[model samples]
Target: MRRTHPANMFVCECITQSLFRLMKRKPYNKITVTDLVQEAGVSRNSFYRNYQSTEEIIRQFLEEKTSKWWSEFIAYPDRYPHVISEMFYHFLDMKEEIDLLYRAGLSHLLMEHIVLCGRQSLTGELKGQLQRHQLMKQNVTEDDSYEICY
Candidate 1:
């Protein structure tokens, strides 16, 4: 999702939540824009303004959550072990969404997002910690690190 206005942000969240609710009642592949907008109590235009597809909703939610977690992860002076522990707790905060994805057979979306986030987060600060502690092998790929971390 783009940087939305405060009001449209509300709509985006509403739509996202509604999608999850609908997924609980039906398969993800069975949901549609009409179903989402109706469930969210928003118009089609509102949904279109924020998301192009249902999968985009899940991806965007994961993106926002990942960004928030990364910001907090880097803001503190905690060691890599503590930060890694916190990362699990941080994502546990989204247990509902994660469970819903699994129940809806959309785990691939979560995996894709995690892989992307893992690649992006292996930057200067965290990478240095991994190297210094010998926590990560030099040849470890992004996917390997993601698997290790999770």
Candidate 2:
């Protein structure tokens, strides 16, 4: 998610909460500003004040969620070896949200985020491994390490 002012947290949360409710009731293409503001118990001006458009809200939400998954993965560095499988489990846990993103035609965004984070995690892991293994370090240059990881 983009950097939002602390004061606007309430506004964004309200908008997001309302969006989730509405999404459960209808398709993304069918939702509107009126439905948003009404469900959130806020005014149209409030909705417009925080988000440029409905799609922006969903994108920001997904970005935040994607960041969260990466943080969870990174927090346990030892899990890097099992990152792909663990991420698959995490995706299964978030099946509802993933389904919603897919239905909204934003599955590409999720895929891009996962790939970006996964690559970073693997890079970090490989560097750590090479640093800890003196014999491996003597044999493997950084480029070779990357190639091996890839």
Q: In order, how many clashes per candidate?
A: 0, 0
TM-score of model number 1 = 0.80
Pick by lDDT: which candidate is best?
1
Error of 1 at 117 (Å): 1.7
- The runs of at least 3 residues in candidate 2 whose Cα sits more than 4 Å from the true structure, single-residue gaps closed, are 1-7, 119-150
Return the TM-score for each candidate structure. Answer: 0.80, 0.66
Which structure among the candidates has the greatest TM-score?
A: 1
Q: What is the C-alpha lDDT of each candidate?
A: 0.77, 0.67
Which stretches in model 1 have alpha-carbon errors above 4 Å?
A: 77-84, 124-150
lDDT of 1 by residue, 4-32 (tens): 67888899999999999999898988998
lDDT of 1 at 31: 91
